[model samples]
Target: MARAYNFAPGPAALPESVLKQAQADMLEWGDAGASIVEMSHRGPEFMAVATRAEADLRTLLAVPDEYAVLFLQGGATTQQALIALNFAAPGDTVDYVVSGHWGRTALRQLTPAVAVNVAASGEADGFRTIPARETWRLTPGAAYVHITANETIHGVEFRPAWGAPAPDTGDVPLFADFSSSIASEPIDISRYGLIYAGAQKNLGPVGLSVVVVRRDLLERAGQPRADIFNYASHLANDSMLNTPPTWNWYLAGLVFRWMLDQGGTSEFDRRSDEKAGLLYAAIDGSGGFYRNDVAHEVRSRMNVPFFLTDPALDADFLAGAREAGLIGLKGHRVLGGMRASIYNAMPVEGVRALVAYMQDFQQRRG
Candidate 1:
């Protein structure tokens, strides 16, 4: 079968060109006479891959010289625990703004380790809206403020429509999980103290993650931890504390290069807006045939979760979508609906195809 438009939340769709290059390199990478996965992390060939990946990522995100970038194994969930260990003392209070499922998960990762003050939460309203900024009760001397930049499952985000793309937290530094939305637009990296994303979504394949942190935060006297869990140690050893996921790193490097060639974040910002607008318009105009419960202003551009008016038709909808060259439209288990995750790799044509299919489905079934 031909390649279908993929919309899985993570381990999500990658650019076709990146996949083709990786396929060719899988047998032998450059003149190394070995597959990238078989090469030593300490070897010059893989070392170059690691170096170029980080450098290209820094350039892609416009990371400041004052910050350090680490390409680590695992996903954003691992970083959740490590961030607390690296940035907060044992008794320190940490402020968290819970907007969606991932935001709640972030709180669980740091419990008992730190004093967590949920500054704001939208759970009371079923996570359909973000609490107004003024209503947040922030801690005065908290360790840091944390927020999920975009919620992949709940279909909510800290969008410009809600207020600032990045919220203001006064003196406390801001930390964000941008797992699903990173590189979809131009971000003011200076405004954030730390930003993390699992590569599977927007960056590349699975088994790798990217963390951008302000250098000064690394010096904090955090709680006792092993050298492997220390962000500073990971940085000191150049993110090669142990055997790194070289294949994922190499694949991500190819993706970064593809993004640069496609005109970087500014261009993606435009494409994201175009694709999301098209999809949302179709949902809103469905005249109750389709519904997305998320508040309009805070709707996620990356993940669009909506429901068919009749729950019984859910299975049929997905089956038809797959038959029409559309896949990954099934919603997360927690939500029990449909979600379209249109990340950077998804073209506007894909969204267009999805919208057309939806219209046809409604005509046939509605």
Candidate 2:
């Protein structure tokens, strides 16, 4: 069967070309006589793969020389907990601006080793909007100010319409969770002290994540932790202090090459806007049949969550979507509706197909 237009969130659709390359390399990689995944992490073959992935990513994001990039095992959540352990000491305050579910999750990962000050939160607005930057109550000597660059589930992002793409934190450095939005556009990496993302969303496959941090931050005498949990140690060992996720790292390298060939982040930026515009227009034009409660200005360009006029129609909607060669439209249980996660891998044609399906569904069931 042909691949349907997938709209699932993380571990989302990968570029067909990347998958095909992986397929070709699966049984044997290069002249190494073993699969890339079967090779030792410290061996030349896998090391070259890991090294190129980071270099290509740096080029793709225009990462600065002062920043160190590490491709580590686990998802963004692991890094969330590690951030405090590596950057903040006991009693050091860390300010957080919670915009959505993942933002709240970031707070949960912290140990009592550090004090947390929630500078701003959109929960009061049901996460339909991001609180204004001016209203934030930043701490005087916080380790860093944290923000979720985009909320994959809540369908909210720090769009230009909201304010600066990266909020100003003054003397305190800015750290952002770009798990679902990384590589979707050109970002001024200098504005952020640290940027991290799970590879599953826009980068590549699952079980791997990327962390880019200023070298100075790695010098901080963070709280006591194992070398394995230390960012500096990970950097010292080139993110191979332990057994790395070789397969995921290799696949991510292929994706970085693909993105660069396809015109890097700028091209994806245009494609994302076009795809999201088409999808949102269909929802906004659906009369009362479809609704996205997110404030228009802050609606996510990556994840678009919308509700049906009748919640009862959700099952039929999903069923019909599957029959129409579309899937992964079911929304998270927190807010039962539907979400179309149009990450970098989702083409404009897919969004067009989705829009057509929505219009047809409305005509039949509205």
> What does candidate 1's lDDT look like per residue over 1-366, in tens digits?
699999888889999999999999999988878899998999999898888888888888999999999999999999999899989999999999999999989988884868999999999999999998899999998999999999999999898753337888888999999999999988889999999999999999999999999999999988889999999999999999988888889999999999999999999989999999999999999999999999898999999999999999999999999999999999999999899999999999999999999999999999
| Per-residue C-alpha lDDT of model 2 across residues 1-366, encoded as one tens digit per residue | 999999999789999999999999999999889998899999888888888998999999999999999999999999999999999988899999999999999999999989999999999989999998899999998999999999999999999754337988889999999999999999988999999999999999999999999999999988999989999999999998999889999999999999999999999999999999999999989997999999988989999999999999999999999999999989998888999999999999999999999999999988
Q: Count of backbone clashes for each model?
A: 0, 0
Candidate 1 lDDT at 171 equals 86
In model 2, which regions exceed 4 Å deviation? 161-164
Give the Cα lDDT of each candidate: 0.93, 0.94
Question: What TM-scores do the predictions have?
Answer: 0.98, 0.99
Pairs in steric clash, model 1? none
lDDT of 2 at 188: 88
Residue pairs with backbone atoms closer than 3 Å in model 2 (clashes)? none
TM match of model 1 to true structure: 0.98
